[model samples]
Target chain A: MNGEIAAILAMDGIASGAIYVLIGLGLVLIFAVTRVIFVPFGDIAAFTALSLASLETGGRPGTVGLVAVLAILATAVEATALVRNRALHRLPRALLFYLVLPLVPAAAVWFAAGTTLSMPLRIVLSLALVLPIAPLLDRIVFRPIADASVLLLLTVAVALHFALSGLGLMFFGPEGVRTKPLTDTVFDVAGLIVNGQTLLILAASIAFCGLLFLYFEFTIQGKALRATAVNRIGARLVGIRPTSTGTIAYLLASLLAGISGVLIAPVTTIFYDSGFLLGLKAFVGAIIGAMVSYPVTALGAVMVGLLESYTSFWLSAYKEVLVFGLLIPVLLWRSLSFSGTEEEEAEE
Target chain B: MKNSIVAAVVAASLGIATAAQAEITVGFVTSQSGPGSSIGVLYDRGMKAAVEYASSVGAEKVKLIQLDDGSDPSAATRNARKLVEENKVDLLIGTATAASTSAMVAVANELKVPMIAISPISVAANEAGDRWAIVMPQPPSLMVKIVVDRMKRDGVKQFAYIGFSDAWGDLVYNGAQKPAEADGLKILTNERYARTDTSVTGQVLKMMATKPEAVLLGGSATQGALPPLALAERGYKGPLYGTPALLNTDFIRVGGKAVEGVQVSAGPVIVAEQLPDSHFSKKISMDFRAAYQKANGMPTSDGFSAYSFDAWLVFLDAAKRAMATGAKPGTPEFRVALKNAIFSTKDLVGTHAIYNFKPSDSYGVDDRALVMVRLVGGQWKYAP
Candidate 1:
């Protein structure tokens, strides 16, 4: 490739890599904080895209049903907690948080169905539908076994990913849906035209990273999440409820997935099975950071995207095999560097 | 005593007549309940409609027992074997993809039962055994010939190729190469990708760098639509040529406005109405559409559907010929007779082509079966 093409490919790579970073950030955050690998992150992204497609067609998204179901289940858990603790007087607050809050978004979604809404409204609605399920999933699947080993949590995450994919296929058929590009302006930079979407993607990624840094460094909830990530039990001892902290982290992570999906949908086709590959690529990026460092993981993800773009030009067939093959060497290096690292506690 | 003997003979003759008139068992193996099912459902139902139409027109009773292969070639082979061994189907038909079609072809040849293809099994005439198997759709070679012709006519000199990293891609690329090369056009680059690939920017960029005058996407249906859409997004302003399988409505639906002005070689059934009145396939294609719509509420938008429909029509004719020669539906002799009758078919016009099955050519379709079509405003228009 010439210099111009190379530059353009790099831009394309970084644009896509931004999406990977969103997913990678989510994966790393969920893994570090909750010890759950968050296997369904990509699926949630695809679900978000599909919901946007549904909304664009003036139809209610099926994800609204998922939200309502999760809300009811979470509410029941809360109600049982209040009743069993003999705290019936606090039932109203519990109901308001668990029962009423979730339905508001779902009801808004239902009322918004089949009405020609602006693109921004549809995007927000998509985010609103997807954001709640992360905590609901945490409460429903991971919370009961929050103290369990990482391996068991990983297994549960994988199972949830598989089930959610099957549900995605049932909800949205086996076809890839592409939404319109958020922007159509193409510019010729040194005789190489770049899509406006690419620029928007890069800008959004930087902005999101800045916002996230601010949230974690300045916000009290963010500090609680960090404390939980440091030590789940210690956070509880320090009066920071790990559940609420974990829930906030999940919400942030899921929001990233939702936003990434909507942005990436214009660039590529998003299908029910599309998430696994994207998720796997992000997982590789997370692995590169030893699944800990956000800046390192984001940088690694950009490198992965660029490498994938360049190699696919020369060896298109083995591109995936090569990209995925990076894992072996990275794992070997990590093992050699951190030989004294303790493995996750095995489940009984 | 003589009159009693006459009565016994009459009763025995009636029994023989009923035995000869038994419902002809035909097994259909297809990629049902799997990734290919969306297309498989259409082809399967299309054949079902053809059988129903034949029954309405008072053809010999036929029992089409379908087996789902779940999109695996091995499963399709097993289904083919089970149908022949357990169900005792005299004739076998199946498979919506070339790889699985190859699998079913082997079993059909081994079991010595006549099999008809509902999809393009292969492009080579050598693969077609004399009396065992035949294909209904225009082969990939014939279809690609039209694509190359159109590309040349449109003044494209350099061709860049991208297709599925699988058998179908290989078939299309290989088939497209010979004619394309014969025309003295340079093939700048060849890229392969999986059907489930989310992005083709890398490959598309490579093609963009090569700056080919035109691009050929060697894929079928919705999967085939990906590259063109990607190319359009990347602002590659070259004509896009596709295989016959790009005729499906799903291709149009997913491809959206990106597919407009893209040229594809497909069966005349796709643009049946647009085909001239003098075309051989026009009348039969409309009839097949009518039968398909009458049975199912949706119109037949895919030419692959007509493939199975044509398969059933040929089977009906072959079964009639076999029955005339004193063959019974369940016997091995009946299968041999059906095979021979199929081999002898001449000048039979169906939805896709004028099929003249011979000992040398099982795929009896000609250029008449295919039309060069261009996407115009989300509709396939025949390019004269």
Candidate 2:
């Protein structure tokens, strides 16, 4: 209730909210680009943290095995499609993209296992290990039904989240882990000490947002993704392949999740099942954006963080109820504001 | 005719002797794959160690039929039913969480089999006329009383409370109320967080604003470390206390420097090596450690797992008495005998506590079941 305590709580809220923003951005981006909700975004984030924890302990991360299995599955699916289409010439490209590229990080992690690596190296390796998961999951689970109804895709994505969580338990052994803080510095401003980790998290969130803006505004690939997000069929008509754009969306979104994972891991314990709740909280932010606007989503995510922090201060037991309760009013508002939008056309 | 009657009596006696040596099947249900899996795996490991120990020590062959409930209560029910009706187990033990354990309680009663519950269940669950379940772990009230007693001794008037927002949390919070009141202590705050909550900064901040002399956490396993870590981050240095649920290696590993000096009330088995030589639990606790190391390939490092070991000890004792009644292992008569024998368990020594159960009692341990422990240098040191 006091000014110093309020300031500290704000710092905590913003720091955690920044993580939600990162995850929300990924959720909104993926939802726009591929009509899939990408429920497993938080799982990827959690896996990144677990990977870093494994690296810190000088053990082989389970991500290597997970990515390898996904890569093989994706490759087999692609190879079978190629043979069915009698496009033998495209086989080599398929093998490289599906099989070889995904395995590189797994191999790196395999080689890095049990040897002491610097923290920066471990973070990079963790990010790389998680990068292939979302994209390859797209190939194996989402590609065949790429044009399916949004509801169906959402169900599949949710199921994939559970499966990955179960796999996470198998690999991580049910113990929660927290890595060492990225920085130990603290700042004193007006009689309040602010943790350096909070500053780093805010900085990372802002930097990623700025970078994403630049990529979307300046880069051709990013524009292609935006075009697909705007109109999948129209983008395809103009020569942008939705499949490639979808893959790009997954990769970029996963990078956001990966970064958020690394940022949040030191602050709190991350477990195999921890991702679902985080992702769901961010989804509340995404819903506020109507699954469309990035800035609105980011703002809503921060509001959620602030709301959560304040609510917990006032009513700790009902904190989750209050945080999740925001969605009802937001959904009501979204429905009122976006009533005239036409639904997507179903393609055979 | 007399000679034929003598032969028939001899054959029936041989049949009864063979039945006494038959494999006694005991079903184990535990959460192996869900949110509860962290604690569930500990129970599973302890049960494995118990099976090995029983085989080596007892003359009777003990067959353990294990099933994973995946932390689901309904699944626990199904597994318990399968174990009893199909496998025809003589006794039941399992499912780590209270809800799932309670789910198996009904099955035990309806199926006429005795169950040794490893988790604390509500009083209503055991209030049935034909109750067949008895708890292994110390009741939360008894454990919380020790914490409250220590608070009284330390001259602490009020303390902040943070715990999981589940039944376990409610159990601890409610358990502390009467004891805390009697000890002239006041509870300042009641903050709760979920097991999967990534941060408890909000809850911690709220609790710290009250500025109590100490903090008592009702959380268990790895999640128990969250509040302490939050408190440490804010540099709130004060005495911390918790129930036996906090006495685990994962709690220490995750809490790290923050949890040091925090005292917890736990089963004496946790600090077995630190106990006096004459303590009743000391020998069995040491035996449990050896069996655990042999079976799990590591030393026992948790308090939850030992409950399973103790449950096994109780079952072995009761099953021996049940067999003395000349009932076949798979028959209904043997289940009744086992149930009666379990209810009559008296003065049986186990790793955690000396066993004593009554027909109407759900929890059997007294004050001897608990020990106050403190974390120093990342190890639980016996503080009492």
Candidate 3:
């Protein structure tokens, strides 16, 4: 290929890789903190995109109904568990977090669904509507099984992906949605043309990565999460609540996924089940990181995006196979390198 | 209301009203909850409209049993078997994707029952030469030939090809080769993408590098919009051509401005109003439209639902002929008679095409079945 074509392909690759980076980072964060694979991470992103599209088109996003249902279920589960543990004193706080917090955004969406809101407000509303899904799912599905084997949690996560996708269909319907671009500006970088949205995605990815680094290095809660990820037993001994750390991880990851969704909505059509494959591709990036290092995961995800773009150009029919096939060699190398190391099991 | 009344009047004039006591059970399996549901829902609504119209017309009583296969082939097979063995359905009609429909075709032959498939399966799978099953949609050979012929008329010497990496894609691509060769046109590249792929920039870039005269897409429904959107982004302004699969409202809506001026080979029913009033399919297409609106409370915008409606029409015709032989419903003799009647059908008009099925034929249409429509300002306009 000529230099121009190669440059264009690289641009496409980096743009898509940026999306994978966000998703990969979220997957790695959730897996480390919660010992849950969080297979439905992409679903959250897709829902966010769908929600944003709904708001843009003056329709009530089905995310409102989904978040409302999940919030109530979470509250019921939390309430029953607390009452059984004789922790009635914590009930009000639980209600505030589990019920009232998510409901505020849902209520906002319900009231503002059909109005011609500004694009920024619509985006914020979409993010707010989707932000609770992952954390509330933690309360409802993962928290009770917190001490279960990592394998079991993984199985449950996979099952939850199917259930959520089915629910995605019920909520969003079958038609795919692609929103208008956030901006119409185009840039010519020495003969390579780049759209404003691509620049936004690249900017967002870099900003989020920098923010994540700063937060981990400088913040108390971030250190707590890091400690929990490093050693759950040691962290517990140091008075770190695993459940609280898990919640924080989920919330942060949900935000990342939501941001990715909003960024991606205009670039591609978002469907109810579209998230699974996208998430799976990001999971490959996480695997390249050995499911821990954030920078390596981001790098790996970008590699995947570049590799996918190149492969599609060279071998269009086998693009998915080639992209997914990279996993085998990475897994083999990881196994060989870490053969004798004793990894901490997720189970208590 | 006016349309349904017209449909009723047409039904009365046709004299298809049969004895209500002789009931025929029809089993319909469709994708109601999975990836295929986008098209499956159309089939579901079409069958519902067909059932409603038949009842209003005082046709033979039909006990319609519908099941959701969830787009799984094994589930479709299980559902088909259950309908035949438990419900004793006289005929079978669906399950949306080609894979599931092929699975049902096997079940139909194995269960010794006649079936109508609403999706296109590979001819190898439909090798049951004795014909216990037949396809409702036009074969890719017939549909793609029109697109190729149009390409020839447009003075295009070569084109790029991009489609889904699946059976449907293979069907369209394979169907295009012979006609393209006959027309002396070259297909420069064959690129494929998954249905759920969020982007096709890589494929589009590859195609653009080849610099073909035009592009032909083998994708359908919402996924079909991907390549066009990518091409438009790259500012590739050559004409686009596709088959009947691209004739859906979601495709136009999703593709938006990028898909404007795309020419697609479609069933006559899609542009029913644009068809001359003397056209054979015009009256039935109008009736089907009215019946669909009355039953579903919305207009039918895709070509898929008409397949189901045509399936019902064929079944109704066959059922009437089968009963004329004095065979009781739910018996093996009745099924055999029904199969024979369906195979011998000649000049039977429906919304999409006039079907003339023979025992050896898997598909039952000719060139008269297709019309070319171009996407103009977000609506499919009759191009010819």
Candidate 4:
């Protein structure tokens, strides 16, 4: 292959790898803080993509309905908590924040769905619908089992993935939908064409990931999350609400997944069950980071993207076999290098 | 829902028991749920329309039973077994995919139930099939020949192939090779991918590096839509070709303008209006097309619907003659009679092709079964 063509292929690989970086950050954050595998990370991303397509078609995204249902359930849970604490006056506040909070954006989406608004506003509204899902699920399902074993949490996460995908099928119908590209400009760079979408993805990934790093380094809540990841009992003993930390981790992770989904939809057709594979690939990248370091995980994910691009060209039929085969050597080397981290089993 | 379905089944059985009548039972096992359901839904609509036509005209009464395989081959086999053993269906119709159809066919032959596959899962009339299985869809060889021939006429000789990593992909790749070699065309690269793959950028780049004259993508339904879109995004400007398995509206709808200028071989029923009046499939195809539109409330239809309609016609014609021999449908004698009748079919016109079956070739459509189509202006225009 010519140097220019190879340069473009590497760029394409980096573009795809950017998505994996977003998803890997989410998986690692959720796993470190909450000890949950976050198996449904990819499913939510796929749903986010479909929601944008639905908005583009002027139909209320199925996620708007999901947000409303989750809002109602969360309100009930908070109401029950208030009654047990004998804080009767706080019921309306709980109801307003939990139930009414979601409705405003959902209602805006409902109104704007069929209108020919600019693409950016519609995408923001689609993200508005998907962003709340992680926090709601963390509260309703994961928080209850917070003190449980990692194996149980992992199994439950897997089950949730299956349930969400089934519900996705029912809501979205059995059709694959593609959205218009955010930008159609193709720049001629060094005699090789570069897609505008690829540049957008790479820029957004770096900006968001950098913001996340700053948030953790400077903010009190970020330190609380870091402390919880380091030692949950220590954080709780220091008056940090471990539950809220878990909820925050979930919210950030979901935001990453949702944004990744909207960015990905234009490049490929999105379906109800397509998320599982994407999520699994991201998990593979996170594993390469030892599921703790953010930068390393993102780096590993980009390598995955480049490896996938080059290998598929060399051996098209064995692309998957080779892609998955990458994890074996990484695991072996990590195991040999970090033999002192045997407390991995005892900590979880 | 399960209770209600069982209640309905029981009530229907009671009604049949009181009437003391033997009804022809035909079981259909297809992917009514899961990723393959879109293709299954179309075949279901078309087959139901055919059944309505026969029932309204007062042909031999048929009791249709269906089971969902969820696009799983093992599930299809289980459903076929249940239909043959528990439901006692004399004839079986199933499966929109080649792999699931093979599973269903194995069960049908083992149970001695006459069967037909509505998709391009070709079943040769061999002793292994026990003369009990046949396919109604156009052969992959016949369909791929049209694309190769159309390309040959346009002075194209070399191509690249990227297909699914399954039976459907293998069929198109192997089938396209037969006519391609005859016309002195070379396939430079052969790539494969799973239907559920999130991207094919790697494969598209490999294809572009080789610089073939054209690329042939063999994906069924909307899954086939992905590769062309990816190829276009990579700025690979060459003619494109596909198989009859991609003859669905979803392919065009999801593929968008990127799929414009794509050429393929499809059943005449897809572009029935464009076919000449002298064409053999024109009249029957027009009738079938009208019925499908009336049933679906949509003007567009594809080879998926036509295959099942042709399967239904063949089944109805055979059931009519089999019933005349005083064979009760729930008996083994009825299945044997039906299989024999299917084998005896000759010159029976269908929406897709003429049904001419023999002991060794049950899927008996010749070159007339397929036509070349080009996607121009987001429409499938007849190219020949």
Candidate 5:
């Protein structure tokens, strides 16, 4: 490919990579705070996009504005619930609690928005509806199960997966539904063709990463969350309520996931099962990041996305085989590396 | 309490009286769920409507025992057994998927019951050894020939093939290739993708690289949407063609403006507007649409339902002929007489085509009617 074509392909790859980064960030956040992999994170994304796409009237307000408003409201409600519970000390437990609570409201909003709206509106509505859902999930299913075994928690996650998948099927039906892009502008700058929506997604990823980094570094709560993540007992002894910090972490992760859904929906139409594949990809990205370090995880997601895109472009039919084949070896190496560290940490 | 007792007695007596009267039972099986449910819905609606119509015209009431096979071939076999041995159905009609149809055909031949396949006609051809199996809809191969012949007539020389990487896709490609090759039309490229794979950009990119004059898509509307969308996105403005399976609203919903100018070979049911105005054609178009929409929330597209309706008409006409021949109204005699009458059918105008069945050619190739339709304003408009 010439420089111009190469630049165009690179731009497209980056734009696609941005979506994976956002989704990966959400997975990392949930895993970082609660130490539980939220497998249904992609379902939240798919549902949110579906809701947003289903909410469009002939000339009604756009999905972004509606989603922003809903996100603010959900954040406020979840924050209040955390305060009332006085269980702010156990940040991880609280985070799990908050993540499970929002599914009901999310489903309700999805149903209400589904009947009247156009494809774009439904997608936006779905995104807006799911913003609070992650925190709500933390409050309900995960919080009570915090003291349970890791296997039990994993089982719960699997159960949640089934529940979410079933609920999606019940609501959306078996066949996949398509959504229109939020914008159609494809910009040609320096021989690089970038879709307007993809550019926005990239911008959003950068903005989110920057904002999150700032929050974790500068804010008191951010430090508390970090301390809690590092050592929950030590953080509790130091007067940092780790539980509340975990809740905040989960809420932030869910917000990122909801936004990711909104962004990805425009590029790839949201379907009920779209999340399973995305969740698997996000999980792989998180694993590549060592399930810690937001920047590393986000970068990992981008790399994986690029790998996928390039492989797909180059190999066409066997792209999946190439990408997945690469994943197995990487995962085995990571497992071996992590096992050594985990043994050292235990001995220390 | 007294009224309830009297009503129960009346129901029991009526049931006994109906049981006393000689009755013929027909079992119908089709998909009620899964990805292919839309076709199943159409089949169910068409079967029910035809049966009701037949009942209204007949002296003896015909009972339809229905079962949902969920589009699973193995489940279809189980359902076939249930309909045959358990339900003791006199005749069996079923299965929307090719695999399911094939499985049921085996079961029907084993059980020695005449089976009418309501789905694609490809399965029937695959199991041509089964003498009892009759495909109501003309085979995809025939449909492919129709499309290629039409394209040839229109002076198209070069073509591309983009189809689902499944049995349905293979059937269309296999059928279209021989004719296209015979007509001196060069096959520019052929690409295939799994139905579950949402993205078709790579396939479209590969196909466009070959630069064919026209493209033939062999998949359902949802699967069909991706290639056209990718083609449009990549600025490939060649003529797009598809199979009857693409004649669905979902394809337009997904493909948007890209669906425009794309032509496909559709069954007579979808291209009913092109057929000459006749009582049979108009009634089939109007009544089938209304009844299908009423039974199922969504409107029915082209499927076995049209053939099922035709099958019902053929069955009734045969029954009337049998009665005319002084055959007894009892089950065995009625079945034998009906089978003989059906075999003797000639020049009978039905919904799909003119039926003329013979013992030598059970499916009656003359009944096959195909038309090319173009997507105009998100609706299938017949292309002459």
Candidate 6:
């Protein structure tokens, strides 16, 4: 490939990878905290995007913009309510409280941006919506069934999936709506054209990743979150409330998913049914990351994006087949490599 | 409401008293849900308008019963039987999709109720033979032949076919292939994809690799337009060709500027605006557009209005003939009279085209009905 084409491909890969990372992060967060998969994460993203797009603008700010404003206000009220409740009585709970606080700002930005918002706004809004959702889900479904066996939890997740799918159909209609692009500008660099929105997505993904790194490396709450992930009971003994900490982790993951949705909406229009496919891909990305290690998961997402781009370029017709072909082998390799660690965790 | 209820009660009593008496009822079946809802909407509009027009002319009220088949063939068969055996509808008009239409045809033949298909004529029309069935619209194969002939006249030689892998696509291909070959136009590539396939980028790219002068599309409005748009984005400047399906307003909206030069062979609906002498056509076109806009809050496509109008007109003409022949009101004899009248139609001026039905011909094929159009400034305009 020519330099320009290569650059364009690279940019496309990164943008696609960023979307996957956000979705994977949410999945990882929910799984880490609750030991349960949050299947509705993608549905929420699809619903929000569709609802936002459907908002008609007669004049002034549109319905989507108005909804976004209301959502932001709600997030603020909820955050304040949490603070007033003395929700973080324990040190571990306090750490989780701090971790989830960023969600308020993220959601506000998301709502403020609306449908006319740029790619960056989409990323921020998505993250914000998802963050609160993760904790809310933990409070509602997971917490109620916390005492249930793994099999029971899995069954509940399946039930949640069906319910969410139905809800999506009822709200959004069966036909998928194409999302309007943030910008139609195509930048020609060295003979390779890249959509401006894609570049913005890449930049946003890097910034979000950097922020995540800083949060986990430097913040007290971040370290506690990590400690909780390593040994839940041990962390609780060390003054970390595993439940609250897990909720915080889930919130972060949800936020990432929301952001991914935002980024993805502009690139490819979102439908109520889009979430299942995206969620499946994100699960593969997570598994490829060994279902642990944030950096590794993010990297896995990028690789998947690259694979998708190349397959679409070359095979085109059987691009989906190419995706599954890569996913199966990678999953098998990861399973063999992590068998020992899984056995150790089982014994413990 | 009280008076009508009392009258209905009295009528029911009288009807029960005369149980052995014959009754004439018209059954109208169409897709009210699923992917083909648009077609159903058109059918409803056409049938209702025709009924209204007939009533305005002081004709007897033709009891019209409607059944929703939801575009499923099995549902259509069940519904056809219910209309025929249970409801005892003397004449049947409907079954929108190819599958549903075929199933209904078999039921109609078995039940011996004359069937008038209002939707697109399928490939099965060729093998249908001298049965009690007649299609109002031109057959799919003939439509394709006309499209290719028109394109051949325009100096287009090399061609590529892009269509959804379904019965509709098969009909178009079967019709176009022979004529195209005879005209000396080389077929560069022929590619088919599923209707639900989001991206036709692969199929399009493969076709583009062959570098054909023209691409013929045989899919629904959305599917027909997208691949062309993708081709335009890839800098392919060749003419995009399509069947009547591409004449829809949705195609223009979705395809945007990319569809500007695309040519399609459609019925007379799109060209109704250009026909200055035809007052009936002008009025139907105007009223349809206005009603559709009022109902859906968006401009209705020509296909929806034209198809619906033609379907209604066919029924109205038949009903009038039945009334003229002195067939007893609401009897099986009246239904047969109406069916025979429809078959006897020689040159009826319609909103789309003049329909001529013959008892000897199993399928309806009106040679004068087809018109070729192109997407010009976001609307279908006369191509040549």
Top candidate when judged by TM-score against the true structure: 2
Kindly indicate the candidate among 3 and 6 with the higher TM-score. 3
Candidate 4 iRMSD in angstroms: 2.4
Report the lDDT of model 6 for residue B238: 83
DockQ of each model vs. true complex: 0.34, 0.49, 0.58, 0.49, 0.20, 0.13
Judged by DockQ cut-offs, the docking class of candidate 3 is medium
> Candidate 5, B9: how far from true, in Å?
20
Cα lDDT tens digits for candidate 2, B1-384 = 999999999989978865653778889999988878878999999998887787622466777889999989999999999998888888899878788998898888777788989987753434356678889988888999999999899899999999998888988899899999998999999999887776788888888889989999999877899999889988889999999888777788878899999999988988899999999989998989899999999987678889899999888888888888888788888888988998899999988888898877878898899989999998889998
Could you give candidate 5's per-residue lDDT for residues A236-258 as a string of tens digits?
79998755776788778877878
Ranking by lDDT: 3, 2, 4, 1, 5, 6
User: Each model's TM-score, in the order given?
Assistant: 0.87, 0.93, 0.92, 0.91, 0.78, 0.74
Kindly report which residue pairs in candidate 4 clash with one another. none
- Residue A257 in model 5: lDDT: 79
How high a TM-score does candidate 1 get?
0.87
For candidate 2, the docking band is: medium
DockQ of structure 4: 0.49
Candidate 6 lDDT by residue in tens digits, B250-278: 56766778888787787766676675554
Q: TM-score of model 3 relative to the true fold?
A: 0.92
Local accuracy of candidate 3 as per-residue lDDT tens digits, B332-375: 88899988999888999998889999887879998889989999
Model 2 TM-score?
0.93
Question: TM-score of chain A for each candidate?
Answer: 0.95, 0.98, 0.98, 0.95, 0.78, 0.76
Find the candidate with the highest DockQ and give its number. Answer: 3
Q: Report the C-alpha displacement of residue A333, candidate 3, in angstroms.
A: 2.0
Ranking by DockQ: 3, 4, 2, 1, 5, 6
